[model samples]
Target: MKKKTFWIPIIVFIVTTSVLYLCGHLFNIESLKWFNFEETSNGGFTFGGSLNPIIFGFVIGFIAEWIYKSRNKNRTA
Candidate 1:
């Protein structure tokens, strides 16, 4: 990957992971089993999520990078 485009994937991965975690924590989405929130004595939820977010983030980031490259290619062609 080009140096310029490399940041795209990294940024996308960070953003995706953050948003998913936030949504899971705030909304308590039952669909995502990874965001296993356990209540503590303080009445606050603890994050027990798995690495699924990392994997999914990487995948989405790759797709975003590919799309960006394709668009840039077409524009320069």
Candidate 2:
């Protein structure tokens, strides 16, 4: 796979996580509040609270990768 193609998934994951984190911290809006019911703080990171972003990152990464691969295949065909 091309380096640019590989980075697409990573970029998508980072952007998704960042957007979720910023929305949670700055706007006090928890898009994934359903997953986080308890409060647990460790150092500068919270488990339940922070896990949402990571989960979202994975989800977004998968979706982005799938889409990217699909488009590439179509273009090549």
Candidate 3:
């Protein structure tokens, strides 16, 4: 795959993560809690979560992009 094709997945990941964080902090929506798992310890804050859909989506996007590039490569050759 060309180097540029690899960026699509990365961009998706960043956008998804940012949206999750924004919704969690800015909107104060409890239903969106699954987006980020937050906690406090020793008077400090911690943040984390499974983000399963993001991971799954990225994996699928990467694979799809890979297959597309391969097919295009063969078509042009």
Top lDDT: which candidate number? 1
lDDT of 2 at 25: 69
Q: Which ten residues in a row have the lowest lDDT in candidate 1?
A: 28-37
Clashing pairs in 3: none
- TM-score for model 3? 0.43
Residues 1-77 of candidate 1 have per-residue lDDT tens digits of 48869898899999998777677667777543455667899888776656766788989999999999999999999
Candidate models: Cα lDDT each: 0.80, 0.76, 0.64
lDDT of 3 by residue, 1-77 (tens): 45667776676666765676567557776544454555677677666554654665567667767776888899999
Question: What local lDDT score does residue 11 receive in model 3, on the 0 to 100 scale?
Answer: 69
Model 2, 1-77: lDDT tens digits are 68867899999998888777777767666664423454447535343555878887999899898999899899999
Ranking by TM-score: 2, 1, 3
Worst 10-residue lDDT window, candidate 3: 29-38
Q: How accurate is candidate 2 locally (lDDT)?
A: 0.76
How many angstroms is residue 63 displaced in model 3 relative to the true structure, after the best TM-score fit? 7.6
